[model samples]
Target: MTHSVKPRARAADKRRRLTIEAARVLHEQGVERTTLADIARAADVPVGNVYYYFKTKDELVLAALSEHSAHLDELTGRLDQLPDPRDRLEGLIRAWVDQRDVAARYGCPTGTLAVELDKRADGTLDTEAGTVIRRLLDWTGHQFRALGLPDPEDLAVTLISAYQGMSLLANALRDPDLMARQGDRLLHWLDSLQSPDPTA
Candidate 1:
């Protein structure tokens, strides 16, 4: 008999599974150690089939990173609905901490992959990750700017930087309590930003 093509539904499902498994393997073993064969074995597909979903390991990483960024975009969008800038900042900080706690408890595939991808100065993954981050920051800054603060962008950077640093620290300590405490401190600092600057 002549060859026949698989249905599109099955192909889409396979690609979804491949992306999920690729994230898991990358999280456990890091990008370098996660061979396409490893992903195929974990996904229970032919070794050559990994290329069907992802042309390369880098594509897999970009997909995983995109997945993680979606999590932030959805959550942060809700934070934007709150009109009070200070409250929005506080809520956003806590939300971010909570997300990190859950991800850390679950092995944090995206964060794990980020460690390696971040080191590369030039790569598709790096470029995409940067875009995600800058957008998050800019959106965050918009929330503060809405409050009519004189330097909302400056305050926004301060808030985002605090969240980023505390995430890694809490992940290392594996302590949700620490994250909460640190997040509270950051929120308090954001509140202080609302006051007019010395020159203003």
Candidate 2:
């Protein structure tokens, strides 16, 4: 029983590693260009082993999508530790700013994946990709609601759209500084949304 458990655990670990590498490769190379061999090489697993874990490229893509979703959850969960909704939102922007270099080179991980998968005629992959962006919109709206905003949902769309637009430009022009500058503007805009102190 102990020996069997060890092999199962190892298999799970290898599967996870493959998914992680797949996400990285897909982000860097785009979905259509990345092959199973690329993912296997990145993960340091045999190409044959990749088949054992994921029968097709689509299956691997699904695993990578799941990885992106989990990463979003982790990021939001970390920011939720902040006491203030404003602070949480600011933290999120800052996090993106920190990744400006990567964004400039490969584009926003979640955003790029969504845009690419959206072109698929099958619709299934695109639907799954849409959920990641939807989750971000919903989470951002929740933060706006916490701040007592009258138009939380609209504000959420505006904020996310701004970020996505900036990300697109940054990647197109290969400018990391653009993301930093836009992040600062976004932080300032968020600050402006707060109600002024009545006592003052």
- In TM-score terms, candidate 1 sits at 0.76
lDDT tens readout by residue for model 1, 94-151: 7766676654453344444655787866654766766766777788788777767777
Each candidate's lDDT (Cα)?
A: 0.71, 0.93
Could you tell me every candidate's TM-score relative to the true structure? 0.76, 0.96
Query: How much is the lDDT of residue 144 in candidate 2?
Result: 97
Which residue pairs come into collision in candidate 2?
none
Best by TM-score: 2
Off by over 4 Å in 1: 1-6, 24-28, 37-47, 100-115, 121-124, 195-200
Q: Could you tell me how far off, in angstroms, the CA of residue 108 lies in candidate 2 after the best superposition?
A: 0.9
Query: Cα RMSD (Å) per model?
Result: 4.3, 1.9
Worst 10-residue lDDT window, candidate 1: 103-112
